[model samples]
Target chain A: MRSSVALWAASLLVYLFLYVPLAIVVAYSFNDSRLNAEWVGFTWHWYQVLLHDEDMLQAAANSLLIAFIASTCATVLGTMAGLAMHRYKPKLLPFMVITPVAMPEILLGVSLLLFFIQVLNLTLGMLSVILAHITFCIGFVAIVVKARLAGMDESIFEAARDLGATPWKTFKHVTFPLILPAVVAGFLMSFTLSLDDFVITFFTAGVGVSTLPLQIYSMIKIAVTPEVNAVSTVLMLITLTMIVLAARFAPETLKARS
Target chain B: MATPAFADLLKFRLHKNLTRWLVSGPPFLFLLLFFLAPSLIMVLASFRYPGEFGGLAPLRDANPAVLQGLTLETYRFFFSDVIYAEIFFKSFGMALATTLACLVMAYPLALLIARSPRKHRDLMVLLVILPFASNFLVRVYAWMIILGPQSAFAHAIGSALELFGITPVPLLFSPVAVLIGMIYVHLPFMILPLYTNLEKHDPVLLDAAQDLGANAWRRFWDVTFPLSLPGIFAGSALVFIPVLGMFAIPDILGGTRDMLIGNLIKEQFLGVRDWPFGATLSIMLTLMVLAWAGFSMWLARKWSHSHA
Candidate 1:
């Protein structure tokens, strides 16, 4: 009885440690004081500043567009990779798909930065950033989809083929419906990752382009204001909504990433 | 025509081969172009010279006055300049420290969650995941607020130290603040893997240990801890390696004296505009990570073999 009580207390403390800092950030967003040191009368002014700030607005638009496109492409390619891995069991495909996901983000960021300038001679902007996001995001989507595929009975796919359904027809009728949740889950995850990404975007996004993370990073580095706190609160809510919606589709996405 | 059945079989085989390529080829091609080619470019970039102004020098048909063509100058510089290696050592120590802190903090929570009722387990895990799901920067930013001089938490720690006749140290931008940020950002990565491993453990073993008169501490140390080696490895890899290359936490929270491998690499690319040096530092970091990963896997294998 005592040990269980001790375990419960320890776990609760850990949970509080995880959450208290974030709760404080959210609370200070409403504090009207520019100093942001103590409790003050609640005001919506910081959020208002975030909404009207021209730079923040532009960065948000760029982040949304890049995330939408990158996640879409990554989903298609990553789904194909996942399907191929489960069905074909290609040796090289798994290595290529998983390594980029596991390595440090900065390595990929700088390597791509070099590749763009040196080999492709392509100018860094929205296109380069989206392409970079898609490259890493593919690995994540593939892992989730592949995990979903791994659990199912192989005979079902074989059964579809035995019924004389064409390859495309079998996938369309049998496989697609079963894995649709995972696919949607992968899309949402890719969207979140791309949106939250900073290091890769930092390196590949030339002077002309910016994203929300880049903007927020600059804000915190340059000055500390309740406005950063407000922007952070808003970003947290949007992410929470995305993850909850993703959980509804496939709870396994969270597990797979972890 | 030959036999109709034979002809049909040949066509079906051909179609299977086509489908296989069609299914696998696009993603394979995409990764090859984007990931593999870029990594190779980085390897090549490390061997090249910095241009007169910045970036990589022209490889072919270069002006004699400008730095051009591939050379080993960056590697030589890295060898001669002792500071580069010092930074690498500091980053490794920091990674090790962060990994250890996360392991200690996460184990208790993971144990509780694993022992919890099955239905409630997912929700508990979700609670842990929810905070981390936000931008990691914002998560790091939270530390900045709590550790700032005016915050009650920092003041409390500072005042407590003064009672012992020690000076009240400034908290923000110190190594301690960076370490806290590192532990905060990475604790979940440790918890999830350990929980997954512990959840699969049979309650039978603990019962058997208790039957043999082993107490709780002995039972855990002798049985449960040994069994969870693979989980420890996975969790450690997730936490340790990323910490090795993290810059933002240090950049935002670190004082003037604190610099890690990630900051050094970032400076070369973005601040210094020295592409070759940046690529060299990246390659070195990758090699070190690979070596460490390889060593840990070997150790885990030995532990498992002995336990088995």
Candidate 2:
């Protein structure tokens, strides 16, 4: 009894350690004073400023646009890579895709930056940011989708093929339905990753292209603010909602396994 | 309904081969071009110099496609630069420290989660994964407020410590601040895999060990620790790899004084417009990550094979 109690206390304390900072930030978001220590009164003025701040507003818009486009592209590419790896006769595809997963983001970011700025001579902007995001996001999508594919029973595909179904028909009628959940999950994950990314976006995005993260980073450099907290609380809420929804709809088996 | 579908697949093997290629070819080509090709081009460009406005200029006197011929100047310069060398070492040291700290913090948490009552397991799991659900930047910035001197938590702690005759160590803008940021951001990555593996462990085995006259420490060492090795390796890999190139946490918490490898590469590529040196550093960093991953995988293989 004592040991179990000790374990419960330790776990709860560690979790609180993990979340208390986040709670502190959310609490101070409503503080009337710019200083983070004392709360004179509760107010929504910081969030109101976040809404009204023109640069922030534009950066948010850009972030949404880039995340949508990049996630969509990465989903398609990643699904394709997953499909290819599943179906390919070649012995080399797995090693190729895993390379991106193992490479440090900074290394990938710098290498891509070098390719764009020097060889391609493409100016950095929103376009470059989306491209950079898709480059790595595709790897994540492939890995997740590949895991899903590996678990799916191959006999279903074979059964469909035996029933006089064309390759495309078998895919549509059997394989696609089974993989659709993974595809959707991969899409959502890629979107979240693109939205949250900082270093890659920072390196690839130049003048006139500021994502929410870059904007937050610049503000952080200037000085820490309750405004950042207010914005973060909003972000955290949205993320929590999406994740809960995904978990609700994710396949029963995967949910259990995860 | 009872047809041997496996037999049909075997009979149509040749056609299946062609069909599979047809379906998977597009993504293969896409990765080949955008991912593999760009990396190769970067490698090639590392040997060339920027011409017009520091962009790659067409070679007028050489083969039409060869923009600029190979040169070793970039590698030479990177090796000779004191700042680059210092940043590289500092990044490695910080990453190692952060990994160790994460292990220290996470091991206890993982043990707690693994031993928790069945009713609370899901909630416990959810808490571990929660930090990863949000934006990376916001997560780091959250730490900024928590550690800042005038921040409520910091101020409260500071005042309480003063009353007890202790100096509240200045937490913000120090290496300790960066370490805190890292531990906060990465603690989940360490715990989840450990929990996954630990949750699957057979409690009877440990009980059996105890029933056979093993002590608590002996049971833990002989059974529990060995079983958790896979989780430890997975978690360590997850934490160590990214921390090597971590940019935001150090930048925000450590200030300009605590530049890591990531910041150095960024400065070279963007701030200074020195592409070749950046590429050299990136290559070196990539090699180091690969080396660590290879070593970890080898260790995992050895552990499993011994058990087998």
How good is the docking of model 1, by CAPRI class?
medium
lDDT of 1 at B190: 97
Q: Against the true structure, candidate 2 has what lDDT?
A: 0.78
TM-score for each model: 0.98, 0.90
lDDT, candidate 1, B1-308, per-residue tens: 66998989999999889999998999999999889999999999999998768898889854677677789999999989999999999999999999999998898899888988889899989998999788988999999999999898998999999999999889999999999999999999999999999999999999999999999999989988988879999999999988999989999999977899999999999888888898899999999899889988998989878777
* Total clashing pairs in model 2: 0
State the weakest 10-residue window (summed lDDT) of model 1 chain A. Answer: A1-10
